[model samples]
Target chain A: MKTTAALSRLFAGIQADLDLVDKTFQERATSGLDILNTASMHAISSPGKRLRTALTLLSGKLNTYRFQKLLLLSVAFEMTHLATLIHDDIIDEASTRRGHPTVNALWGDKISILLGDYYFAKTAGLIADIEDPRIDHLFSDTVATVCEGTILEIMTSGNADLSQETYFEKIKNKTACLFAACSKGGAIISGASPEEIERLHAYGQHLGIAFQIIDDILDYTQDQSTIGKPAGNDLRQGMVTLPLIYALEDESQNGYRQQVQSLLTQTTHKEEDITAIVGWVTRGNGVKKSLLDAHAHGNKAREALYHFPPSPDRDVLDELIDFVLSRNK
Target chain B: MKTTAALSRLFAGIQADLDLVDKTFQERATSGLDILNTASMHAISSPGKRLRTALTLLSGKLNTYRFQKLLLLSVAFEMTHLATLIHDDIIDEASTRRGHPTVNALWGDKISILLGDYYFAKTAGLIADIEDPRIDHLFSDTVATVCEGTILEIMTSGNADLSQETYFEKIKNKTACLFAACSKGGAIISGASPEEIERLHAYGQHLGIAFQIIDDILDYTQDQSTIGKPAGNDLRQGMVTLPLIYALEDESQNGYRQQVQSLLTQTTHKEEDITAIVGWVTRGNGVKKSLLDAHAHGNKAREALYHFPPSPDRDVLDELIDFVLSRNK
Candidate 1:
């Protein structure tokens, strides 16, 4: 939680502009229908770190760019992220987000689904008005990647034999693809050199993958109240996140593999089963192995930012790398 | 059933190009995820009249244009239309479409949701490469409208007091907006005169509104086998379409209103109630009034196209105006 304050401090230079993106997003999401407006408001009104939007703003400082268009693109990326979350809640049947009831919980799954669609459309509408074909391509391709990754995750759910390669592919699609697009798109709109764009894109990729790993890790380590989501909820729901994947692969933890496998196949789990699984996952070297992976990715993300000479923007990005990996430090 | 041949004939000049749109769209909607690929292939493979794609191709012939780009844009429009249908089925909890099992039925709501999103992203990817901001603007704006419209429809599903004005607004957003964008976008891409673009857009608007009216009326009038959907489906689901709105307003049908209203408010409806409502809708002036409304809009659609000098494309469009309003003729 202290890392959030650190993350906020990193955005101090561009706080006002980030707020503008927030204001613009809220103001634009209204559909003029009462129910839709209510649902849309509920979705955007929820507290999010807005990390992706911040990345866009921070990246824009690296070069000369149209400030308003950059903000719009940033909002576009945030909206797409929000869109995915709305659908994700439905897919997960999640009851809360940021400690507030989700759109699916407040409204029904039907309205939630449509509101998710609305956000995706709203994102496209934002970028479609921008003249940069590269940004358009990046945003749409990222959308494809996100959806494809999610569908793959859904398809592979409950399989204990899922590989590390497949897990990386899934998380990259569901999380890193959009992050890569955010940084790359910001660079493109800023008229950065092609090489710089590629570097930032790679930076965002590593950062996003590491970020998701921390998220899954925190699901096991953090309190349910702190995360605003049920702890080990993924395991109970038959989802195979990185932590569980590592536990399954650890020879040292093989004693509990059959127990975890049996729990995975169970459609209904006792609360005790979840507790036992979490205990084993934490006690094993799985969490350590996962953290080691995140550290490596965090290092790679920092290496990608080496292209930019020291500036406030690059410094802020470096701080974000620390923020993402700060769980250990 | 008879209207099918006439609608196809309306695309006579662009039959081959329309086929190319179909082939291109089918080839492109695949996401390489086996489940998504199967679902998408199922969606595109199901027999659709492909009227929206035809409209784009026909509208392009109003002036000389970049032929392949126009075809691609047509495919883009069709894909967007299909994306909306996929989401709509989930919202409706529909089991079948066009006499075939829907993606939702085959896979589940979760996969259906992602596949629908995949199609939307695919459409954006197609237009993002087109090098035209107008096409991008049209595509995204239409997406927003379709979603907002559907959300509004979902919110108002059980309300018996829905107004005719609201009904038209809903249909315009849900259906006409995409149709309007298709024609207008095709004209923009083809470099048609502003007047021609406006005329075609208005034509599409009127045509789409009438098309939806016919769809509602067919629910009351057509056989289950002919329409591929259950009769009185909208009424059973508590949807008050144009015919129902007209029936409720009819002075001669005053007695049925109380009974109909009661039935609507019930969460689970009896088939007898659906039968009674459908009988009243057809036997009363409801279907007549709805058909009369369709005819008026159909006439207006035809009038918009009169601004164009007669050509094979123009003739085909004129025939479409008839196809939309035709029930028996």
Candidate 2:
């Protein structure tokens, strides 16, 4: 398990390129409209881990590095992720993200919806500027998949009947698919062969699944301040994530399934009820089982990395898998 | 002004191709998921006037008509329009559009948001399939401009002090830009000369402005049964459109401006208050003034069309300008 400092240092090889991506991201977010510029600037001010950006840069390095094209691709993917998050916050009615007020919380749903859309438009423009048909197709299909994944999540909300297969499907659509695109897109722009592109794509998919599983687990185990959101937030929203799915399947836990069903169907979740469910999931082997599944994915991601010769960028990606597994938030 | 039957006959030459566009639109709306397919199908089912489709087809006809490429472009533009309408309903909190329940009204805002995004993704994928960089840039820029226009409209919603220049800017961004893209896209695909493309772009832009001006006018003058939505609908939402703008500017109207100012600042608009304001605007030169402005743009559109040699498609486009000016709904 890497410490936060160690995790931050993992990307030392691509740190400069990642910094350039951040700069480009901020520049791309600027708009001619005062309100749009301000809101968009605020939206990108609190940056994420930039894991996708790193994946893109690192994957590009695996073949022939095209720094300029990779930078634009990285920015586009990051913008796409940001757009989805703004819209997601609207659906979740989340007031804050990463300890900062959400666009939805600050500007209202209408503004947030427009801002998310603005980011999407900006992303499309950037992809078009890249002018690669394959990248264009990959990006378009990935975004569509992300939307489908979100739709699937909304449709399956409150169903304790959600299966492991369906859970995998949802995460793949919502999270892993974009990760795959980042890697594959990087590979394509760097002129990597098709087989190599597929390998990186596989690598990103497994890493993304591991990342989302950890996120779901942290939702149960972490407190509000740590995760920057309420614990059991997904459960409160009636989202049947992997841990809850496993927890409910454990019939040995004294009618716990009925408790979950009741909680899922509740009109409004009381805080204590959410706490109790979180405890049940954590106390049972749900978090541990989810962790094991994440580790299995992490191993697959590592195996994908082994297909390429060892390089500094590959080491950072390998360490990223560990970071995904071990991070508390 | 052409009769309804005559207007329907305007696109007779391209009717078969337009039918194919509708078929493509329907096929593209389908998804593997039942809920998405159902919601998306419903969204596209209540089709608005396919004026954009006609613009694309007619512009293509002015050059070497590439029906296949133009068909895809038309469908993409139509889907883009559908996607915007779905999101617009969310912002407006609108229940019915085109005498049918909006996706936002039936499926809720969350699903509607995702479905809109799914359509956008589908649009992007279709554009990528066309593999034309110029088209790619045009489509991306057009979508972004639409978002900017929508944001501008929301920002200026309650401000009765919004300038006519700004109003023109808003409509151009929100409506005319896409129309320009439709015509320009058609011309580009059909291998039109640069000068011819510019003329078509200009034609579409002016026509779109005229079209939206008529739409705004209809919102003020038409009834719920006529327009499929309530009259003064924009004003109810605090949208200061052309007629209202002109009425507010009419200082000689003996305190009518005060009535409008007071109404604009009201927290909740009463039905009768809206009706009274509508009557004031109609009685004054507001609607008439707005109609003159529509005609001015309509003339400019006609001028752009006259640059091209007389052809069957060109004649249909010429009638289309009259259709834009005279349409009640």
Give the number of the best model, judged by lDDT: 2
lDDT (Cα atoms) of all candidates against the true structure: 0.84, 0.88
Give per-residue CA lDDT, model 2, range B264-327, as digits (tens). 7787888899999899888888899999999999999999999999987788889889888888
**Given the true complex, what DockQ would model 1 score?**
0.79
Per residue, candidate 1 scores C-alpha lDDT tens digits across A1-329 of 66567767878888888889889988778777778787877788776547898888778779985688888898889889988999999998888886899888988898888888888888887887677888888888899999999998998888888899999999999999998988888888888998999999999999999999998898888766777776787887788888889888888667877787788778889988898899888888788989999989999999999879998789989988988886521
Q: What does candidate 2's lDDT look like per residue over A1-329, in tens digits?
A: 23446756887777788789989888888888888888888887874547888899889999999998998999999999999999999998889997899999999999888888888888888998898999999988998999999999998998888999999999999999999999999999999988999999999999999999999999999998787888988887889999988888887985777778788878798888888989989999889999999999999999988999998778888888988899887
Best by DockQ: 2
| Candidate 1 backbone collisions, by pair | none
List where candidate 2 sits over 4 angstroms from the true fold.
A1-4, B1-4
lDDT, residue B93, model 2: 91
Interface RMSD for every prediction, one decimal? 1.0, 0.8
Quote model 2's TM-score: 0.97
Stretches of candidate 1 off by over 4 Å are A327-329, B1-3, B327-329
